[model samples]
Structure formats: structure tokens, C-alpha cells
Target: MEEQSVVLVVDDVKTNVLIMRQCLKEMFQVWTADSGEECLRVAKQKPDIILLDVLMPGMDGYQVCRQLKADPETAEIPIIFVTAKDSDDDEQKGLEIGAVDYITKPIRPAIVRARVSTHIQLKQHSDKLKFMALHDQLTGLYNRHFLAERAAQSLSAMVRHQQELSIVMLDLDHFKKINDFNGHHIGDLVLQAVAKLLQDCFRKEDVVARMGGEEFVILMECGLDIAREKTEDVRQQLARLNPMGLEVTGSFGVVTANPQNAELSHLLVLADEAVYKAKADGRNCVVCYQDGAYLTVEHD
Candidate 1:
């Protein structure tokens, strides 16, 4: 069963809070905050939707909504204004401030539930579309787009901190043979299995991504030595996998860019050159690129 969506109800009035809780409790996991200050704190939890009252003691709902919308983390959250301040100007102001819907007080339970349900559904759909845009449909790995997005950010931080960063690029050996021999469906399963192994072998901080068919990249905050060692280990593990009883191996290229030239695009190019060298030397081997020289670290 799917998890229940969370709804945060923010209001200063105890009775109104109780009423909203009663109306929503059965349909959602309802969380309540009695003041705008507490609502801001609770908003960090990222509830699916927020029901905010426009008037409160210290900070008003408008201030809360403005703050939430200002923050990138919480900005996408849907906010619905539920209050007694019922007027054309009040509703217009609330809508202008980013509330998805405005409901006047002396509230009808049924109408509030229906509106909340509709907006929550819309929020879910929007969230899914965003996820699909950033992820690969196959293998469920980060696609080239996400990899490029994170690469620039991480590269910037690496240069700023004077820290080490390395790129490990992998390409399956003779991948077309797998699709030709085992069929695309079995080949897909092999790719997924390898992706899972990559995920398990790398740390949470590492960015592992699929850069189109049969090619993958790993970004890690380590020197060439550590990157090559880790890539070698994954290479051995992948060789042993034999996913679906089909033997498979991948060629790996490891490279650490110079601090003065810490650019992802340039680093990737060197990594690709190293991978090509690995394929030339022999398949299922690890190669490191340093000072424009490719060194074979491991071979099988």
C-alpha cells in the first residue's frame, strides 16, 4: 500500500485547528502548528500540503507563506489559505502571495477535503514529472543531464576547497554482443544489475550516472590513486556478477584533473581517453590518466 500523504494545518485558534484536524485526519496524516513561528519550523519537514490561516499572533500566515515560497526547499509545497478574512481583496492578496486556493471560514468540511484532495493530487503529479526529468527511465540511475548538473557544482567546490576530485568512467566491453546474443530484455537486466552494483560500491556522496548506452561515470572526492583502487574493486565485483548467468566485464578509466584545470568537461575527455586506452590494451582492465599519460593499473 502507498504511504499516506502529510497535511500540515496551521492556525492560531484552537477550535479552528481542531475543526480542520477533524475534517482532514481521516484522509491524511494531519500535523498542526498553533502559530506562524511553529509553522515555519514544521514546514521544514516538507509536508505534502499546507493549510495556513491568514491571521495569527506573532507572524501572520502571509509572512509564513512568503518565507516558505522564498526558500527553494519548501517553495514547491502547495499552500491553501483557510481563514475567516473573507473578501475579494483578501482572496486576491492570498492568491497573489502563492496560495493555491483560498477558503473562507465557517468552513464546510466536505468542500475543504475536496479542494485539498484535488490540490494534493496535482502536487503529486508535478513531483513525479520533476523526478522523471532528472532520472534515467532505464537502470533507474542518474542520467547524463543530472550528471552534468552536479558535475559543475562539485567541481567548483573542489577547486574552492583545494580538495581532490577524480572521475571514473566505465564502458561495457562489446555491449552490442550482449544485446545481440541475449536479446534487449536480457541486456536490460544486465545493465540494471550492474547499476545496482555501482550504487552499492560507491558512497552516498559519490555521483554515479549512466552517460547513455553502455557508458557510466562516477564522480568522487578523492585522488587518482583512491579512485583507481575503488574502480578496480568494482571491476572485480562486476566480473564475478555473471548476472543471469551471462559473463560480463567493463573497462574503466580514472583521472584527477589538475587544480588549475579543474573542469568537468576536460576531465571527462581525459577519462574517456583513458577508457579507450584500456580497451586497446585489453578489455576488463583499469587505466589511469595522469599528466597526459595513460597508465594501465590493472588488467585481466
Candidate 2:
């Protein structure tokens, strides 16, 4: 079952807060705040929509909306001004300052419910579209564009923090033979299973992306020895996984470096070369590139 969307009702009056809560209780999980200060602080709860009262003391709804819109962390949340201020200029100001909508006071529960539902639906649709743009359609992993963007951020971490980053390039050995024997449908299923394995093997903070086809890249914040061990784990697990009742194995190329000295692209090229050596030495093995040489990481 889908969870209820969170709605925050911000009104200085207890009665107004209760009324708005009653209006949205059936459709959303409602949170209430009596002041703009409290609203800004409670916004850490990350509500999906905010229904704000404009005429309140100690920072009006317009001020809260401006702060929210100015901060990238909260800017995307939809805001609706529910206020007694019915002047044309007031409504204009609310809308211009980033409120998705403006609802005048003497609140109608029906109108509030209708508008909230509509805006929430719009937000959900937009979020889904954004997810599609960033993710691989086949494996649900981060796509190439998303990887490049995230890699830029990781590169900054390397330069600013003197962080060591490990890059692993993985390719399925004889993947074409698997497809030629079983057909592309089975090949797709194999790819999905491998994608899940990669996700399971790495931490959430790690950057795991499917570059294309049977090739995938993983970026980890660690040194050479740790990366080689992690890469060995992936190789051992993939060898054991008889996904779809067929044997599946992968060749891994591990490269660990302080990325201030090398870009992400250079690391990938080095890893790709290691993967090539792994394939030539016979598949289903982990190879590490270190000290200007490739060494096969032997695993039991």
C-alpha cells in the first residue's frame, strides 16, 4: 500500500490549524505549526505540501515562502497560501513569491481538499518524470548523464578533502554467447539480476551505474587494498549466482587513486584496461591496477 503524503498546515490560530487538519486528515498525514519560525524548523520533516496562513505575526507566509524558495533543499516543495488576505495584490504577491496557489480565508473544506489533491498529484507526476530522466530504463540504475553529474561532485570531494576514490569496471564474460544461446529476453533478465547484485554488494553512498550493455562502473571512497577486496567479493558472488538457471560470471578491473592527480575518465580508462587483462587471463576474476602494473586479486 502506498503511504499517505505529508501535509503541513501552518496557522497562528489553533482553530484554523484544527480546521485545516480536519480538511486534509483523510487524504494526507497532517502536521501543524502556529508560527513561521516553527514552520521553518518543522519543515525539516520534509512535508510534501505546505498550507500557510499569510496574516500571522512574527514573519508572514510570504516571508516563509521566500525563505523556502531561496533554499534549494526546500524549494521544490509546493506551497499554498491559505489566508484571510483577499486583496488582489496580496494574492499576486503570494503567487509571485513561489506559492503554487492562493486560497482566501473563510476556508471551504471542499476547495482546500480539491486544490491540495490536485497539487499533490502534480508534484508526484513531476517527481516521477525526474526519476525517469536520471535512471536507466532497463536496470533502474543511474544512467550515464546522472553518473557524469555525480562524478563531478565526487571529483570535488577528492580535490577538496584529499579523498581516495576507487573505480571498478565490470563486464560480463561471454555475455554475447549468453544472449546468442538464450535470446535477448533472457539476456535482459540476466542484466537485471547483475544490476541487483551490484546494488547489493556496494554501500548506498557508493556510485554504481550501468554505463551501457553488459558494462558497469562503481565508484567507492576507499584505498587500493579495500577496493580489491570488495571487487573480489563481487566476482565470487557473481560466479555463485546461477541467475535464471544459467551460469553468470564477470571480469572486474579495480583502480584506486587520489583523483586530484587523475580525473574520473582516466580512472575508468585504467580500470577498463585492467578488465581487459582479466578477460585475457581467463574470465571470472578480479584484477587490480596499482604501481604501474596489473595484478590479479586471487580469491578463494
Candidate 3:
């Protein structure tokens, strides 16, 4: 099924909102905000496109556009100013504040629809390109480059708030045997399946990434106890995945993020150590880093 793109229409006038809704409803899911404050709040829903009206009471469209552009979360959402001011100067100001296009008042349905459709298509293309750059093509998991960036940002916030953070480094045990006995095509399918299951095992806030061949990592917001339990859960799930009668199991190494030593590289090193320990203890197990030691956790 094709995903429905959302269009946020912000106007003080109810008639304007109704008109735009009527014009665009066939092509997009329409949402409305009658004032600037409501527009800012609704924008957090991450609409695919926004049709904003200038001259709203207190906060104008230009001001609202500036705020949206300033926020990293909402900065990329396409905005178009639809207002009564037709002067070139007014249009220039709208574009200057990050409005993608400007449409004067006395709305023409065809023109509004055409402009909105063009901008929405452009935004969709931009998002697809960004996803290709940040994600792994084979497994649809995040690539290592994006992983480092996200890990750094997440760690910074965790440290500032003194919240617990954990990293789980996982490797498919005896994965080479499967690739050698079967073929790369079968191996690829196994990797994809593992990636999907790992993603399902964690919360949305957690970061799951394909580090490289047969390796994955999860950055989650929890301490040792919860991390260990989750790691074991993943291990048991992988063991149950017998693709083509081939036994599948993964070794996991987990480490909590220490605020004083919270660098991504440092965390990876600790997690790696724990994973190696799991391997030494005869694969298909979980090891956790605690109090400067990597200790194997007995399965629950």
C-alpha cells in the first residue's frame, strides 16, 4: 500500500483552510492549524508538506518558518507561504525565512494543488536519497557511519542527563560455516532475517546497526540488568531461527556507557571485549562489562 503523505495547512481563516483542504485532500492527508502557535505544535507531527498563511495574530508565518528551520527535527519539512501579500518584497522575506515557495491570497485551486504536489514530490525524493546514504542496502539496517554519528549524539544527551546507556555488540556464531556450506545467496537471506529480528527486539529509541559482515550493534537506554536480560532474549531468539535446518546462534557483548568515558569508540572497545569473552566462553552466550571487568552472564 502506498503511504499517505501529510499536508499541514496553517491559516487564521477557516475558509482558507477549508478551501486548501478541498483542493489537496484528493492527493494528500490534510491537517489544519488556525494560528501560529498551533502550527508550531502540529508541525512536530512531521508533515510531508506545509501550506502556511502569513499575517496570523501575534506570530506571523515568517516567524513560524524561522522557528521550524532552526530546529533540526523540523528543518527539512517543506514550507510554502500562502498569504494576501503579493509584493515581491513579501515573497522574498518568505523565501528568506526558508519557505520553499510563496503563493498570494485569493487562492486558485489548480495552482495551489500543482505547487503543493511538486514540492511534496521533491521532498519525497530528498528523503529517499537521505535514507540511501544513511542505511545499509542489504539488510535495511543503519550503516556504521550513521551509527557513529547517532551514538555520539545519543551519548552526549545521556551524559548530560546522567541517564543509563548500554551497547550490545553481536556476531553470528559459526556464520562462515553457513556461508561456506550453503552459498552467499543463502547467507545474505540469513543476514537479512537476523537484522529484522534484532530491530524487533529493541525499542524505537534504541539504535540498531549493521557494523560489517555478520556483526550488529544495538545502542539502548538502560543499565546492566536490563541490558543483560535483553541480550539473552536476543540470543535465545536467534537460536530458534533454524534457516534450512542450519543451527543459528549469536554471541553478544554488552557494556554500559560511562559518562566519564562515554566516547563511542571507547564504548565499542568495551563491547568488543565482552563479545570476545563470550566467544571464548564457547559462543551463543552473553557477556556484560561491569566494574572494569567483562563477565559472562549465565542465561536466565
Collision count for each candidate, in order: 0, 0, 0
Superposed model 1: Cα runs more than 4 Å off: none
Off by over 4 Å in 2: 70-72, 259-261
Expressed as tens digits, the lDDT of each residue in 1-300 for candidate 3 is 797889999999998899999999998899999999998899998999989999999899989999999989899999999999999999998998899999998999999989998999999899899998999999999999999998888889887898888999999999998899899999999999999899888888889999999999998889989989998998999999886677889999999987778898998998998889999999999999999988888875
Estimate the Cα RMSD of every predicted model relative to the unseen true structure. 1.9, 1.9, 2.1
Which digits, one per residue and each the tens of the lDDT, describe model 1 over residues 216-280? 99989899888988999999999999999999999999999667667788888899999999999
Each prediction's whole-model lDDT (CA) = 0.91, 0.91, 0.91
lDDT per residue (tens digit) for residues 1-300 in model 2: 899999999999999998899888998999999999999988877899999999889898899999999888889999999988899999899999999999998989999999999999999999999989988999999887888888778878887888878889999999999999999999999999999999999999998899999999998888888988888988989999899999999999999867434677788889999999999989899999988999998766
Q: List TM-score per model, in order.
A: 0.92, 0.92, 0.91
Q: Where's the lowest-lDDT run of ten residues in candidate 2?
A: 257-266
> In lDDT terms, how accurate is model 2?
0.91
> What's the lDDT for candidate 3?
0.91
